[model samples]
Target: MNIEKLDLKSPDLVNENFEKLATLFPNCVTEGAEGKAIDFDLLKQELSHAVVEGNKERYRLEWPGKREAIVTANLPTTKTLRPVREDSVDFDNTENLYIEGDNLEVLKLLQESYLGKIKIIYIDPPYNTGKDFVYKDNFSKDAQEELIDSGQKDEYNQRLIANPETAGRYHSDWLSMMYPRLKLARNLLTDDGVIFISIDDNEVHHLRKVCDEILGEYNFVAQFIHKNNSNKNQANLVSVSCEYFLCYSRDLEVLNKEIWRIEKKGAKDIVKAFNQLKKQGLELDEVLDEIKDLYKRPKYAHLSRWNKIDEKGVFMDDNLSREGGAKDYTIINPDTGKPCPIPPRGWAKSKVELEKLREDNMIYFGDPSTPPRIKSYLTGEDLSVPDSFWYIDNSIDTRWQKQTFNSLIFENPKPLELIRLIMEMSSAKDSIILDFFSGSATSAHATFQLNTEDLGKRKFIQVQLPEFTNEKSEAYKAGYKNICEIGKERIRRAAKKIKEETKADIDYGFRVYRLDSSNMQDVYYKPQDYDQNNLDLFGDNVKSDRTADDLLAQVMLDWGLPLSLKIEQIDVSGKKVFKVAENSLYACFDSGIDEDFAKAIAQDEPLRIVFKDNGFKNDTAKTNVKQLLKQLSPETEMKVI
Candidate 1:
């Protein structure tokens, strides 16, 4: 396939000033192609600023189907990695899934069962490091009915070809690669969804723009500063210390707090309360302020007046909220070794306040032995100050992207802790989380972990290209041949970890699929003048081993439609295609798209009808397809396998 790259400089590149700086994988950023790699340095010049582009939150693609969401008891369309039975893919039994094929296609395959469902999605793609890109061929300009004609796409891509150096449109290339995929990812997130992207200075800006465009600019949550590489070599300028985590959410409002909270060491009041009650049988309030020198706070009990505590939580009353209360008070200054004078109004406890204090038994002197003092237990304010910044150490590096980019796998990859942190504060557990550039499968990891903690059944759908690895890299040694390989392994490992750790009885693994040709093979059409039996138009006619999602793509193709069209898998019917341009087509490859099924499909006045030739045992009935087409749908075009 001849790959025609557009202009070297993406002229209308509104996101950033990309003319400056060097890059590791130049192809990752470009114009009129997949996408532009982000410039992490430029994007993080300041935490709030980055190269901005189109509205970050607005999506370029509008989802087409909403009606056919249910899954049916039986399906006759294409093959999918669906659970044959409820227990087939038990949420509690297995922790990982290794799906073969394209990530985009897989995302489509998963749309039905896992919408707004994943907790995290981590992916490490071809950094567009020109030498490592490996895009599979789907078709070409020629009248090619088939290429590989297999489920697996050949490994003929950029890795073998000369690397395309970073061009003037550096960021453009990476942006193009990310945009559409990100749009698709948006659908798979739970409300409290979070996405984490791992990128250096090269194309961070482009990522931010793309994220903002698809995830909503308002959803730009936060960027975590991560030390990606520990620079040891000396340089002319400052050694770059970190990578940025581009984060966003499904919805920004209705966020929750306390999801990522760690209980602080017991507050001082807690210790005092427990010790006083258990050891002394005395309420803290009963003897808190009876008699102690201003400078003698640490050893007040040494005075020995309150030798034995007899009560717990027992206290003298203080009338603070009462009208005209707290008329008398004693003020002491420890530093000055003196007492501050009472106010002209006769201290906070004036005559009126004094009378109230006496009634509540709120005053004491010479410690508890002489008398008990008032203790206001109600004074505990909502005053625990949470640190504004999350400490890097507290962030759990999840098991994702461990073996990617050769020897560059981040061991103990940063977990979706960062994602969870951002997501919990801005989304409900059910919001969608779109992570276009998933690396190390962290987003998915975080989502799964969060689900166990949340107990709220949220779903996730991930999209990642099959970015190959350098066989010699350290990551490859750890057992991954490509970035996608690592991604799959991480999901599996995460699943296992979750199952063992949480023992959840709910479903979690994603139904895996990938981008590919339709499951239906190129129709073996005979010339119009041929006189042999038109047996092709019979039942069970489909690519013998293609995937269900692929078959859906074929349905679009035979009907002259775009492969990217939306499809829904219903519980009662199997796969349903919608937003059908020009007309509608219902196809099934099951052994028999029988008479009952045919009639079922015809329930709607579709524009066209195509089915498996094997489904019709009666030749006469097969020929009646044209007549049926006229009656069931006058405008419908009917044909057989």
Candidate 2:
């Protein structure tokens, strides 16, 4: 048996596209110099009834470097995310992740593991207001070289090129930068997943067009108007006090079928008060009176209709009549044993359904002569659909951040209430939330806060570029050299504050990872360029600076495994082994591997196992280990890196 070598690179999207086309039209799949290529003319003929021609006018959002952007999205990256144990909160057990890297490369690295898994993506990217910097994806130079060529090292880096409005490619540069990232982000969304992009007037129109092209125009859900600022005296023409959140789904039909509702504002506090009043063991009449008095307050005025209480809790009487004519039926009052008065239209439910409701004591009949009403319990009907307009004050968030850090570290962070509200509306209890453009880690902070409130197991993945802070800025003076530092620190402080307030049992920890070059040396990727005479010069294919943990991380990415899975270190025949997800995968980079160690591990019958190329004592030992595994555990597949 030939042992497989793990391909330590991100997925090749161009080949995947070719395979998809081949499956749809086999006749159009022709062999080319490199590999299977598409016969575009034949494919077009199959798709259309008329003869298809090239260079024909069609509707598309075109811009300078658009083709290059498309190429960049398709290209595979050799970058890897190495775990930072010291910076992490709970490196082994926590499911939450905070990654520092250029989001473009990070998204590509996550394509295999997180594909179609993210339920909600909320990003607060740069508004491109002429002063902000746009990410420039240049594959030609190394990261350090690019940073140096852009400006001084302490200033903005090349990845963040200043796109002033005076430049000729102002709109084009922003579009090119956003196109590839959006394309990659769409791949990570679940079928029913949704994305919320926060933007201002500067590029909302262009961004919407780009999203329509990539995420599909039919998937557009809503363009929410968030009135965040009450004071906008800097405006030239009008008081531009609101920003927008453009929401789109991967598949709108699927999302529409799912219920997207949030608890009514002030509803939870009313429930808590009702529960407290019940705990006091007051009389039912007294309890009702107290609830009514509570609802009279201005804070609970919206919930005044639900002041009535019974053994089943607070509720409001709702109309039981249906509009536009239905089958009229009499609902008997069980208390009076008489036919209750019916509305002019009809009862909303059928006879059988009405009997079910009557048996369940859901109908409220005040008098025998009056029409019966449905008792809509507050606990059962407390949810309401979110609206398109939201008015949240921006100063509230600024104040909270200042209090959390004891210093003003970030400017204009998103409101925690807004993020929590969005998550509650669109996400499930255990859904994965991603924010690739996470600035001060407000999304993660909001996730922790919401989880504490609802006891949810939702996990968050925050990715941010470690953009350098200005030398004279408060963030730098406070010992934060980069944006990622501020983001991570905010999460820590927010988690601490939330834990102290709620004392809730939840996963308040996160694992930190930093993007870096692959752990493998150049020879591992390109062995064809070397000859046997000089092969001994580079004895180990792995990098000298890389450790076992780094290799494990890269292997996980290469094998399409999530970085958040539980990882445990075990001992097998006095050799160190890394077990992930309890035998889902096992890796051991130690040397002196022989038949005894192979037999020891194969007995556990792990689903997959990996070893370093030079870990075996010799070629004979490596060949024998494969044979040993085949005989001992036929189900276990082995690989080498």
- Candidate 1 per-residue C-alpha lDDT over 1-641 given as tens digits, one digit per residue, 9 for 90 to 100: 99998778756654444544223334333233333444454344433556545434543421111011111111122433322222123332333333444554455555654566655544444455444333332322232333323223344222122226554334443444455456666776667665656655656766776677668889776775654224522568878655566667677662343244332212234335445545664444445433223114321222223332223332233322334434355433333434443334334444555446645544433232222233443211223222333334322242123222324454445545555554444445554444544545666666677678767554444455455666776667777766666776666667677878799754466544344444445556557744445555443446566544444444554455423223343322443433233235555544433444555556666676565555554676666655665667677676655
What value does the lDDT take at residue 214 in candidate 2? 95
Tell me each candidate's TM-score. 0.51, 0.77
**Poorest 10 consecutive residues by lDDT, candidate 2:** 149-158
Among these predictions, the greatest TM-score belongs to: 2
lDDT winner: 2
RMSD, one per candidate, in order: 14.0, 13.5
Cα deviation of 610, candidate 2, in Å? 0.9
Candidate 2, residues 1-641: lDDT per residue as tens digits? Answer: 99999999999998799779989899886544333468787788899989788666678776667888999899999989889989999788899999998899999999999999999999998898888998888677777777776663543232778988766578777888899999999999999999999999999999999999999999999999887656444667788878999999999999989988887767777778778888999988888888788767544565778866788888888998888645556767899988888777887878888789999988888767778888988863468888787766567787886776677888778888889999999998899999999999989999998898789999999999999888988899999999999999998888888999999999989999989888888754366778888778577888889989999988998999988899899999999999999989999999999999998999899989999999998999999999999999899889999
Task: Evaluate all candidate structures by whole-model CA lDDT and list the values in order.
Answer: 0.47, 0.87
